[model samples]
Target: MDGYTTALVCAAAAAGAALVRSGKRYIDNSAVELLAAPDGVRAMIEAHCPSLVAPARARLVPPPYLPTGMLQTIYGAMVALRRDSESDIEYDRQLRTMEDGGTVSLDWFPARPSGPECAQPIAIVMSGLGGSAYEYHIRCLAKHLATKSRAGMRVAVLNYRGSGRTPLTSSTMYNGYDTSDIYDTVGYLAQSFPRAPLVCVGFSMGANLLARYLGETGDKSRIAACVTVSCPFSGETAGRAINAPGLLFDKFFQPALTGTIKRIVKRNQDIIQSGAITYDIDAIMRAKRVCDVDNALTARAYGFKDCWEYYAACSSTDFIERIRCPFLAINALDDPIALPEGLPMDQIAKNPRAAIALVAHGGHIGFFSGLSARMWHLQPVLEFLDAVLADKAE
Candidate 1:
């Protein structure tokens, strides 16, 4: 072919690639079912989180390289490596001594000044398993709320005991079943900023904890609104899915998560040796899957007979019915870790205050989209939060 013909062919190929990369992924059956939510709540969510509706274009399109749900879910696990335009958020760390002599760390992001009375709304972020305030998604949410949110929201991340490098002052460690640390942290924030309306956003395992806390506390929960992203609501199903034989689970998630368990145990070895943790630490270290770690550590740590009992206890379906606060659960149908089959849709349906945002394609906590496929969940979360606050103010 002549030089001109060759150039035209190349340009055509480039255009095709661009179209493929930037193509919109429409959500099927995208109307967000509000369950038993009131008309007002439904209207509020529809107005704010329009992306939840069906036939609407899903903001998250898997990168060309990572097209499948499993691949995207795996990508989410390594989000810390993708340093996008959102800058690393710096936080002022505060170490608080819990009632049990255990210590937890709170990382606070500076909010645009609300006033001398600290009247701004507060957003407390709870990171995923073995994650911290430094996690990429956490920073994105904090940055959005602190810099961009109309509420001028002050953001604080709760680094549970032994996670986020927080020192284990006592033999006690955090588990999916326990809500004490979060409960205490919420109380502390409430006291510190009495005038500030408190809101919460929890990711993955942290989401489960937040859900359980809301249910256990019922109407007494101080949180004005809450959002849970990629929560493994049904612990049994979620555990099985994560431990199942698969490219992502076996090669990546299992080992990575098992390693996190070992590291947590090793980091707090001095405290584990003191008592309370009755499991075989050496065996737990050799464990190949997350369930094994849960069986040996999490179940035993929380006084359960075994992992099965622990899983049953950790199930959020039992808790969702009791949650009286305005709550939203964002779940991806394609989530590999937090299996979509495990979503507490029935449980959520029972509570008028609760709703679930079911999207067709977001994998686990991965809702990455746009030309670059950067994190996309932040926008919907912000919208829901802003709506809740606005509704409350009225």
Candidate 2:
């Protein structure tokens, strides 16, 4: 073919591919129609993600604490998802004595091997900031989802470096987490379960990591697909949004991180007494805030200049268009953590390789829609993952 003809064909293909990558579901108010909650839940979520309270038949769900059929079972897990204790705290444990810089032990759910003929895909779950494998009802969801299908999936929860056993090799972590860790873990799993399909899901902080992985890695991904729930694509906007005064976010999260870090620091009094580092443990915790935490910690602990440099280097916004795999990112405008400014839903919708699922609610890592405030943890999350993976075979 002539150069002109060849160029035209290439343009057409490119346009078509872009179209395929566009928004997963037609957004706007219609998206929130699926949430099942009281008027208060809608209002709460809307306060964070306004688009989360759309007019879906989803409201038909029964209220929490009430006894219903299968829905009750799911609600039980939701309650569990919301509950927390000292163990769930991220950075508060006493750490001066612990050798691993107060890092928690690594935790993971067991996975059954996925032999051939099984369409059921295994799901790898990534938890949010200061969150453990137990924090967000993930355990409940994993257990519950396993019961539904024939060849049940293996649900593996990713505890960030310091959150669990994988303590920080560095002092503090960054906003855009180390995607390489997740990629490596998933790679290890794929090799172990060659016949089984693998799917990945992340929430809030975890979601950002997943999105980064999607955008950064070229089209040749080993995992089947990914779901990013409540992730902020643009670091600056999200940082600004969460940092905004009067939202109660800093108040809600800072103490959690501070408290955790203090506990760890106190535990390792010997390390402090010996002057392993210049600053005291409490001083380190005091330096952390929603916006400043990543920088404060990284600089003091891991030795980065500031958070901006770290965010710029790690943020996934630059990698969006290069992703070749099929993935779905769920967002809610009302979510306090992930705002919709430079989120670029239009760009996502235009890309055929993506399924940009947007909602108006499910605050940060708190997407309990269609779930009750009872039970142990979030149950339906596994179902959502299951449904998404099952679709892959069809």
- Top model by TM-score, which number? 1
Report the lDDT tens digits of candidate 1 across residue range 251-292. 888888789769888877878878745658898888998888
TM-score each candidate.
0.88, 0.65
- lDDT tens string, model 2, 1-394? 9999999999999998877664222222224333222332223233322232335422223233332322332333345445454123222122211333433332434444435444446777776665667654555545555555444765667666556545454443423556666666667667766777877777767877887777766666777766676677777676666556653445654665556555554554455445344544455556656445555444444355776656555566666666665555665555565666756565554555554544444445544333333321233344345444555656
Model 1: which residue pairs collide? 30-53, 30-54, 31-54, 335-364
Give me the runs in candidate 2 sitting further than 4 Å from their true place: 1-120, 149-151, 165-175, 261-282, 299-304, 370-394
- Candidate lDDT (C-alpha), each: 0.79, 0.53
What is the Cα-based lDDT of residue 47 in candidate 2?
A: 36
Which candidate's lDDT is highest?
Answer: 1
Scanning candidate 2 in windows of ten residues, the lowest lDDT window is 89-98
